[model samples]
Target: MDFKVQLLQRKSKIDKVIGEVFKDKNGLQKTVIEAMEYSIKAGGKRLRPVLLLEVCNILDGDIDYAMPFALAMEMIHTYSLIHDDLPAMDNDDYRRGKLTNHKVYGEGIAILAGDGLLNLAFETMLDSINNDPKLCNRGIKAMQIISKASGINGMIGGQVVDLEWEGKKIDIETLDFIHKHKTSALIEASINAGAILGGAEENQYLELQNYGRCIGLAFQIVDDILDEIGDEEKLGKKVGSDKSNEKSTYPSLYGIEKSKEIVSGLIENSLKSLEIFKEKAEFLRSLAKYLEVRDH
Candidate 1:
């Protein structure tokens, strides 16, 4: 199958799983459910979950067992986005071509919605584990990987650095720290979690970690590039917010051409790390290439 078709197939599966969440919810707490549903259902690439599943597939892992983890990872990702777009953060009004959570649901509800999603993500994972005692060890390990990635040592820590350095003359080291923690951490966790669930060897796990890191950094670099020059319509969000907010980005520090070069290098490194998987990694190779040229 073509790469796009394969990607859409995985995305469709994920969407179906996510769509079933809170569907029958009602009563006084329904508003918060609506707020949570609104953000998660808003369309985007679903890259994190897709990565988890694809890695599981490559390692011949049980997709049924992995499904809950995929959903949980996406929930965590969506919650982060909801919080990231708050008035105190980036203060954005649009995401995935729709009104942001805070814009329609109000900030207080939006915050609760984000928190709700975060808690529910762990709930989903734990539910899956409790229902299948056989999967306890691997499931727990996968959950730990995701938890640390989104915790203070990972995404939140990176966010703090990014927020603190806004408009400051930051050096390359600081910029690298922000990118590695804020963006690359979760991406790495997704791949690593999948590898663990799939029973990968130590070497395979390490190589996939390298691949994840390269592509994760490249993903953010492309994001920075698009924010500078991409079409708002295609991106489904306002462009140039990074500039207005004075966020330190790859393009801001290295210039567009240089940033493109850096992305190319990262993509190359990612591909090289996948060489051991050979034909099995075709989808991931194509994904890395797509990241280099995508507008959104």
Candidate 2:
């Protein structure tokens, strides 16, 4: 199948899972659930969950068992976006060509919605484990990877640096730290957790982890490039916020041409890391290539 076709299929599956997550909305907190549904249903690439499932598929793991983890990964990612777009954070007005969470649901509800997603992500993972205690060990391990990645030393830590360094002259090391922690951490977790649940060998696990790190960094670099020169209509969000916010980015540090070169290098490394998987990794290889040229 074509890469985009495969991508759309996976996205559709992910969307289905998300849709079912809040279908039975009958409680006092229904509004919060609705808000949560609003953000998660807002269309995007669903890259994190797609990566998680693909990793499992390539390793011949049980997709049914991995489904909860994939959903959890997406929930955490969406929660971050909801908070990221708040008045106190990125202060954005749009996402995925629609109003941001706060814009439609009000800031208070949006805040609760983000919090609800974060908590429900854990519940979803734990529920899976509860339903199948035999897989408890694997489930716990995957959850641990995700927890650390989204925790204080990972995504949140990176966000702190990103917020603090806005409008400040930051060095390459600081910029790298922010990217690795804030963005790359969760991406790495998606792959690492999938590898664990997929029963990968130590070598395969390490290689996939490295691949995740490379592509994750490259993904952010592409975002940086797009922020500078991308079409806002295609992006579904305002462009040039990086400059307006004075955020430190690969493009800001190295110029657009140089940043593109860097993204190419990272994508190259990511593909190389999957060489051991050979033909089975063809989809992943194509994905890395796609990231290099994706407009949004």
TM-score of each: 0.97, 0.98
Per-residue CA lDDT of candidate 1, range 134-154, in tens? Answer: 979989999999999999999
lDDT (Cα, tens digit) per residue for candidate 2, span 95-131? 9899999999999999999999999999999999899
Candidate 1 residue-pair clash tally: 0
Alpha carbon deviation, residue 227, candidate 2 (Å):
0.2
Q: Please give the CA lDDT of all the candidate structures.
A: 0.91, 0.92
Q: Which residues of candidate 1, in runs, are more than 4 Å off?
A: none
Error of 2 at 192 (Å): 0.5
For model 1, state the Cα shift of residue 50 in Å. 0.4
